[model samples]
Target: MSKPDKTSRHGERRRFSPSMLRRGMNLYPPFLGMGLRVKEFSDDWTVCRVELKLTRFNRNQQGTAFGGSIGAMSDAFHALLLMHQLGTDYHVWDKAAEIEYVSPGIGTVYGRFEVSPEMAEAIRAEAAGGDKVLPWFETELTRADGTVVARVRRQLYVRKKKSVTERERADFTG
Candidate 1:
């Protein structure tokens, strides 16, 4: 269950119930691929706890996980969080993403994104008007050794697609 957005500055401290996100897999692909478990997320931040599945890895010559897989895990967190917090009636896509290697990525990888209420507000403001892309967000990927494997910045497009009310997002109390 997601908590109500206490700080209204992030547009409106709205909570996109986790159960709702779970039922909407058709809306996201990476979430399906990443198979992430959202530990926690508010309007401003998110923490996703995921294990690096061997099946999803490309063993390098040295047996370390593939850099692309590492990057993908990190990048996917931001997209998942955005959808969970912001609700539907908008479109989101990875505008751009970048990753920096820090370790050998020897073990399970975890991804986290701090969205900040201020940033969320900004995204709402930008998308509230139209379908223009919001500014990019930076998230981090960490290895089991507590080393930063990659830092990713993803640009997103959020727009009010056809005046979505509470029901469209299934937020209606009735």
Candidate 2:
């Protein structure tokens, strides 16, 4: 599979560098309000680590992490990673999500997301035919000590852009 052109589904060039994305995510209203901070975002957009600190703003009545906040930790990342990897020719979006609370999140918890080259290749192959593909991914929210706090499952919708498909058809027929 070829590397993506770093354009959005709207065909605009992606302007944010990895650091910029990390900073932007940290300041993003919902994340900021929920005490979520992106600790690491790799230059290749393949690996991202986010930390959720238990604070008054995101604490439940039981004094643990808010369920909404925990769910938020899994939002947008899989789609973002796959979009960047698949480039302008494809559209990627979060189609569905589910979070299973394993334990009360106390103190600080972390969520890590990774998109391997093999995974990207598989997705590209699956979406090459211009049909939408829904792929599921899973990650864990863990405590500082690596105890599981929650399990998050995300499904992303990916499809080749119609323009790309049309252009390819023209190339073949013309």
Candidate 3:
């Protein structure tokens, strides 16, 4: 198959495959307005960054990046990480999410979402049985000054199709 098109024109590593729904958030006014960047991604995890620009400033607040921006980043992070673990066969979608704002934003905010070993095992077990809601996790968005601005917990429902024994090695898509 051909390589998926890169998601950004500015040379950010924050690219996504065609199957990634979070990529569609680029069209969202709230997310796009925050200038979120997918700086890096691999099979294990994803790192996303965002800057609080004047456009993101509501009421001219300099310290807090838009709450929506932090939430959106959290959503994208968990969704993408789950996708990596579940692959394309099992449709994974966000079931629920929560964010806690702990402190004011200082500078560029970065978030990282990682698929845990236990979660992977749990997901595999879930698919082994049948389609089911795998698991959910929490991630923190922090500023350059080391202040955690928000904690986001994301829940996802994963629907399994063919069992691993039934599908080819390469049939798995994510």
- Specify the highest-TM-score model's number: 2
Clashes, model 1: 2
Clashes of each: 2, 0, 2
True-structure RMSD, every candidate = 7.7, 5.7, 8.4
Clashing residue pairs found in predicted model 1:
44-115, 44-116
Which segments of candidate 2 are over 4 A away from where they belong?
Answer: 1-14, 164-174
Q: What lDDT, from 0 to 1, does candidate 1 have?
A: 0.59
TM-score-wise, the better of 2 and 3 is 2
Ten residues in a row with the worst lDDT in model 3?
A: 51-60
Once superposed on the true structure, which residue ranges of model 1 sit more than 4 Å away at CA?
1-45, 53-57, 164-174
Per-residue lDDT tens digits of candidate 1, residues 60-106?
A: 77777777767666555566666545655566666777667777766
Instruction: State the lDDT of candidate 2 residue by residue for 1-174, as single tens digits.
Output: 875556543456787767778998888898888999998877677888999999999999999998999999989988888887777788899999989999999999999998886898899999988899999999999999999999999999999888867889989999
**lDDT at 115 for candidate 2?**
86
State the number of backbone clashes in model 2: 0
Ranking by lDDT: 2, 3, 1
- Which candidate number maximizes lDDT? 2
